[model samples]
Target chain A: MAESVSEVRAWVNQRRGEGRTIGLVPTMGFLHDGHLSLVKRAKAAGHAVVMSIFVNPLQFGPGEDYDRYPRDIARDRKLAERTGVDLLFTPSVEEMYPRALQVTLRVGDLANRLCGLSRPGHFDGVATVVAKLFHIVEPDEAFFGEKDYQQLRIIQTMVEDLNLPVKVIGCPTVREADGLAMSSRNRYLSPEERRRAAVLSRALFDAARRCREGTTRAAELVQSVTQQLSSAGLEVEYVSAVREEDLGQVDQIDQPCRLLAAVRVGETRLIDNVALEAGKGMGHVSAYVDR
Target chain B: MAESVSEVRAWVNQRRGEGRTIGLVPTMGFLHDGHLSLVKRAKAAGHAVVMSIFVNPLQFGPGEDYDRYPRDIARDRKLAERTGVDLLFTPSVEEMYPRALQVTLRVGDLANRLCGLSRPGHFDGVATVVAKLFHIVEPDEAFFGEKDYQQLRIIQTMVEDLNLPVKVIGCPTVREADGLAMSSRNRYLSPEERRRAAVLSRALFDAARRCREGTTRAAELVQSVTQQLSSAGLEVEYVSAVREEDLGQVDQIDQPCRLLAAVRVGETRLIDNVALEAGKGMGHVSAYVDR
Candidate 1:
């Protein structure tokens, strides 16, 4: 475990110098099964896995719970080691933003939809910090979970636009047995809220099933998902079908699409998404959605 | 010479596979002695040099001379060959920006002063394009001429703030016999404007001398240099003393400083700077200024 940026660079460089490829799993601490799945995928690919645990304050908005974001260094360390993580980087805020950040990296259009509509400046913060980590780690490939579907697409766009050398590998979204997507913020839910949080995924899975059942209209899918969540006593923030590529809103599901939604269950917010295949819609629904 | 980003990357990666270090010299074509000096420095340091010549539209304001920027691939190729440049990257606008630029990279306080004041969005364009080039080239060291002193500082800050792995080397500003700084835009000056352009450097060199001779007040030094520029029948844009690192306007020359000025002779705008050593400022003036 290294807490300093320079130390981690030295470790990664030493391994690279010896011709070993590196795979990075970037996460905010409080390790969940979803994060470990990425680590497992990295190790499975014969990469010396480096998992970064930085609760990046940049990705949280002013009103968001940056201060209350979950953190447990000791537990996180144990979880990472158990998952066969080769190195763990936990840098302090001072180490990351030593001075006021003057550089603002804003990815247009793609960031203004989905989660970005409610939490502005979130993906810019994500892109900037991710860019910093990419430079610091210089990994051949980096892993991300599909639970942050918008975030994964944004990073992919940023990498393509910037011509970044690293390949982005997005793993499947790990979920609870009841269908709630596993997330670091899942801990913020109350016992009852946790039970209701499953509705977010359930609603999306239901809508995805409707799409597979020959429902072509995006409005119909959105209306069905919104009704399902509202009936479950969740405040629906946004329920829409967007193209998997640029996240553009799709009126008719003619292509591979991502049915995404965000909802407020009590004071906690939960987001989940499921991929809908274009032609063989129902054939792959079971793979993306946990039954 | 490679005209596309992919071709250049392929060539660079092939060299990297053989363990050869690369040094990048990024420029707008009209190959000057200043650029060749960078190539010489790179080769002197045992690096294979890749020089890029693209008149980036992003670095130009809407009304700036991006369209009229000097470009001559034939002459540039001859000069680069004479200087022993290993490769030349001259990507077109379409190649560099395949789509509308969704990502905007803005360097805060550092980019909002000096040259940035007159030409808004210039440094943002510079920062963004440079970032793209950095990713594409993946150079071990990148070179910039100190003639654009504020630009040099801005790029340094960007690299440091972003934790970019490449080292930024600021080469001494190459000057003409009459002390005019070499720039591709210098060709914009009429022969008569060219004669008076030397006054920009002379005024800065003179102020730097006064600072060494115990002229401590920044306002006094600015006044003297401004008067010199105005007396030469040039329309002075600005003449100020600033701390070297941040370009913050300084009140007293108590530390290492820069005396910078911008002026317009007829329709041509020119800029020059002189670095002042804290106690003995004039000690290094001749290296940056021509007699």
Candidate 2:
């Protein structure tokens, strides 16, 4: 386990000396099936896998669950080893941020929509930390779960726009038996809320089913999904279809777009999405399993 | 000459295959003696040097010199080959910015000072371009002339803050026989403005002399330099002494700091600075030469 920036860098440097390619999986700890799936993908790619578990404070709002964010070093270490991770880095907040950050990254208009609308400065925080990790880990490829679809696209866009020296790979979103997208925050849900959380995925699947059947207007899908989540007794933050790249609102699912939603089930806030495309590049997007 | 992104990336990959360390020197074309000096330093460091020449449009303000900024590609080609640069990349605006950039960088408090004050968004442009260049070229070490001291420091801070994977080297500011710092914009100065431009450096040297003789107060140094530039028929934009790292205003030269000044000589605006330290880290900061 690498605990400092220099330690992980030195480890990567040594591996690079041995002619080994590296794949990175960045997460906020309390590793679940979703994160491990990414690790499996990285290992399957014939590259040494590195996983980082730093709950970056910069990405969390003051009112958010930064303080209560899940962490389990022992379990994480065991799981990482079991999953074939070559290196597991868990740098402290102090180690990652030695001082107040004077230089940071801010996303453009793409941030003004979706989750960025309510959780302001959130994506900027995510971009800044991800950029820092790319620098520190110096991995050839990095993996992200598509459950956070907007975040995955944001990271991909940042990499392209900034020409960051890493290939961002999006893994299929992992879901529970009931269709709730697997998340660390699912631990915050009560038994009843956990059952209700399945509605989020149901809504996404409904939209996907509708889009596949030729009803591709984004507004219609969003309105139907919003009704489903609201009727499930969840506080719907947003339900919309946005461009896969910039999250720009689209009138119809002309290209690959994501149907994203955020809802509060009891006190636990959860978000999920599934990719939809009526035109092209729909093969790898999340599919609603007929459970 | 590498004119496209893929071409440059392929060239760099081949170079990397041979285990050759790369040095990058980014410029806005119209190569001058100052740029050659940076190239010379890169060659001396024994790395295969790659210099990029692109006048970034995003960095310019409404009335600023984006369109009129100097360009002579044929002359630049001759100069790069003459100076031992292995690869010269001159990507076009369309190539560097194929799409309207949705993801870009913004420097924090450090950018709100000095040149950043009057020319707002200038360092952000510099930071963004440099970051892109760093990604595009994958250089081992990048050279920057200390003539743009604030810019050099911002790049360094960005590199450190974000843990960017390149060494940012600061070459001593190359100056003329009359003590005026070398700049590409010096081409814009008329014969009359050219002579008066010498006062900018003189004010720097005077402040250095005063600091050496125990007058290390920043306010006192700024006032003296302002008086000298104002009396020399130049419009003073600002004269400041700031910390070497963040460009934070320093009350006294207790640590390594920089005395920065900008003045308009006739229709041309030129800026200059010399480094000072009453305590430590003074060895490499810019020193005023005895003309």
- Best by DockQ, which number? 2
Candidate 1: give the clashing pairs.
A102-B108
Candidate 2 interface RMSD (Å): 1.0
Model 2 C-alpha lDDT per residue in residues B1-291, reported as the tens digit of each score: 999888989998898889888999999989988899889989999888999999999889889988899889999999999999899999989888889877788898988988998899888888888999998998899999888999898899898888888999998887888889988899899888889999999898778777866887889999999999999999999999998977889999988888999989887889999887563423433454322
Where does candidate 1 stray beyond 4 Å?
A: A278-281, A286-291, B286-291
DockQ of all candidate complexes: 0.76, 0.78
**For residues A1-291, could you state the per-residue lDDT of candidate 2 as single tens digits?**
989999998999999999999999999999888999999999999888999999999989989999998888899899999999999999998898889887788888888888998899999999999999998998899999888888888899999898887999998888888788889999999898888899999888878877877878999999999999999899999888888867888998888788889999988889998878674433433544322
TM-score of chain A of each: 0.97, 0.95
RMSD of 2: 2.5
Q: Under CAPRI classification, how is model 2 graded?
A: medium
TM-score of 1: 0.97
